[model samples]
Target: MDEKNHIITSPVMGTFYRSSAPGKAALVEEGQAITPSDIVCMIESMKIFTELRCEHPGIVKRFLVENEDPVMKNQALIEIEIH
Candidate 1:
């Protein structure tokens, strides 16, 4: 694995989606700037939508799952460059 293997870990248990709506682009892409208050992705569970934001400023190196993939609690949703 390369340094791009950095991660955007999920803060809650649910499903991961690349975009807010179908056929739309992802919230964050490779080399995209990530901020502590940025909404990088959304995790929906129990009919509620939980937007997952970054805890620090960095770059989004990778995303761990495909759109609409079922994820577990505390799973890695993306790989981010912390530095």
Candidate 2:
């Protein structure tokens, strides 16, 4: 099974921030290798920060959402090519 189809998705409804905090570098960028425990981004909801992690290790292929974009529950955030 390929990992490309396994895409990283959002957890809950909130605003998706590329970085952990505002004005900081993004959590991961294109071509970056991310592990299951690695944080890809953070979703802020009700004033709570939620870390979004990958389900497997892979190289980032695309960012489905732009910085400071609103994301819905279970939305596709990024696509990773499973290695």
Candidate 3:
């Protein structure tokens, strides 16, 4: 909740994927500048993949969840530092 940090949370319970598809690049990396509209990750549930976007502009500080990791609703995915 700190002003310098912004957390990206999972909206649903599912498997988290860092890339858009298998063997693709992870959407954003640590220290990468990002905008509110950037796609940060994906959550797939019941064969449905949901694109997760940033709500605040910042640089990605770290990823809290790993690729293919099961995430719960509202689980923190990544942390970013607001620019």
- Model 3, 1-83: lDDT tens per residue? 78888888988999999999999998888889999889989999999999998888889999998899999999999998988
Best by lDDT: 3
> What does candidate 2 score on TM?
0.89
**For model 1, how does the per-residue alpha-carbon lDDT over 1-83 read when each residue is reduced to its tens digit?**
56544566666678888788778888888789878888888888887888887777888877779889899887877887776
What are the root-mean-square deviations of the candidates from the true structure over C-alphas?
Answer: 2.6, 1.8, 0.9
True lDDT of residue 19, candidate 3: 97
- At residue 61, candidate 1 shows an lDDT of 77
**Candidate 2 structure lDDT:** 0.84
Determine the backbone clash count of candidate 1: 4
By TM-score: ranked, best first: 3, 2, 1
Tens-digit lDDT string for candidate 2 (1-83):
26355577778899999898778988899998878988988999889989988777888888889998999999998888887
- By descending lDDT, how would the candidates be arranged? 3, 2, 1
lDDT values, one for every candidate = 0.80, 0.84, 0.91
